[model samples]
Target: MDKHIWEEFVELERNPKQIERCEKNAEYRSMQTIRHTLGRCSYSNKQYKLDEESNVKVVPKATTDKWLMGHQRPDGSVHPSAIEAHKKVLEAKEKNKGKGLSSDDHLVSPELEEVFPCKRKDIIRGYSSTMSKKQCEMAAVASAALQNRDTDHEERMQAIESTMGIVVGKMASFQTLLGMLGGKVDSVIQMMIANAAAQGPISTPSPEKGSTTYPAGVHSRVMETEDSAPCTLDVGQPVQLLDNVGKVVALGSIVAGVTVHGRKVKPNERKVYIEQVYDQKALVWDAPQGDGYVVLSQLSLPTWLIWAEDRLVGLLNS
Candidate 1:
């Protein structure tokens, strides 16, 4: 399924020229468009440069990076910071499942690592089977709330099994997304090559049509590579994707290399465009009774558009 989705994405990028034009439009030159084209936070590298005062390489550490082998919560959500810890814990769990724990297993599941007041380590040690069973029963009770097609209690049991299968399938899909992450890097690298090609020969001085030639000792500047550089994304690498916290809505491919028709302020400052990658608003929870609602136009992040390669843009959910 991952391969199928990625292949479809790749097919979309076959025409880079068209994508370039879309990316360069004035409406698309907004911060929102740039974010989508790069498929990550629109300003992470910008912020880094502001603080450091150095030329920072803007890498596309977007959704693909997050989807890979990162630390996933029990509910199957990945947090950028917790990815490493999650990976270690998941490794331990996989290693020790059904098999007795060994001393080496301690590396992944460290002793006394507690996020909640309760001892998660003790739970893994089987010292809290009663609590575990209680939790499972609670989950079963909660699962009953899910709308299922099955009406009969017996049929509902089958529905629960089917739902669990779906959850497992989604987890598998996230894993597969990570494996296919390498192509993003390839696309960026190829774009750089294309940029190099765009830099053609410099014109020499002609006698009648041009000015006089300089002396032989005069220094001549040699033509180098293009100003734009490419940064590739790695699989399973967790980078903060959005300037603001908002769910990803839509994704599309872009072709905003130097030769493409993107808005170029200077030679290097070209912006990419992302279409349909945001919700009408950002979703958040507030107090009083703690209700969750979408605040329209309050979304801080722009939609995700893959500017160079087959990038996936997060779109507004409207």
Candidate 2:
């Protein structure tokens, strides 16, 4: 054949296993399909028609359709039964069949009864089995008043809802809900930026001489003296380690030595290794990590500070 065809043949021979692997995969898939079919064949199954008796406990199509049509009946009921709704549809179908009106069934609405109307006999027979003539007339008039005169059957119902103020242009839909949320998110981001700008630049504190960098997992606790106490009325332990008292926000392998507030701590008696910090809520000093040594903070810390997963989940679930 052509030179290109010969080259393709040579390339195919170079990868003979490719076609074999593909065929093997296809065969494996077909075997799986047959297995599934045989498994299903081993079981007997039956499908039943869900009839009107089931309608008593279950929602009906008419009720669903009425809700979709913006009709909230008294007692917040939906269509009474699927059979009734189906009958109405069939009546409408038969009335419009083999006639000039059939060509424009799409053109008629409850609102356009005065202009391009569906037969009054069909309307009465289609719905309102228990309603009086006067009641039917009133309903037809109400429907016409709600719908647009020029709109089709589908548009007519929507127009009716629009006329009654059931839905507005500003109303949210599934597709637009994300965009609305995004707008709120954008506003929040802008507020944060503005607040940060108003605060001006942040300055870093210089470490004192001869101070060692605080290791990530290391913390130093200084107990309050009698004069430095927030309140001396209710007394407890004088020297308390914050980490041992409070929760542990993060737990990870130690990596390097750094103070809780990002200060460089010099290596002293403290073990140094890089690890994740709880947060920048408090000051952490370089301290030796040994048995019974834990980082703790004051109870007056921000409520957002959470130490443990259980505590966080409990707060959120509650």
Best by lDDT: 1
Per-residue lDDT tens digits for candidate 2, residues 1-318, read 576998888788678797897777676454321111212322112001112323331221231122123222323343353244444544554554544344222322332232223576644322323322233233322222234223346677887888767455546464488776888889999999998778653321222211223332232222212332221112121112234333334322212334423334343312122233454353333221222223424322321121211111011111
Q: What's the distance in Å from true for residue 49, model 2?
A: 35
Q: Could you say which candidate leads in TM-score? A: 2
lDDT value for candidate 2? Answer: 0.34
Off by over 4 Å in 2: 1-175, 204-318
Which TM-score value belongs to model 2? 0.17
Each prediction's TM-score versus the true structure: 0.13, 0.17
Q: Which runs in model 1 stand beyond 4 Å of their true positions?
A: 1-88, 97-133, 140-318
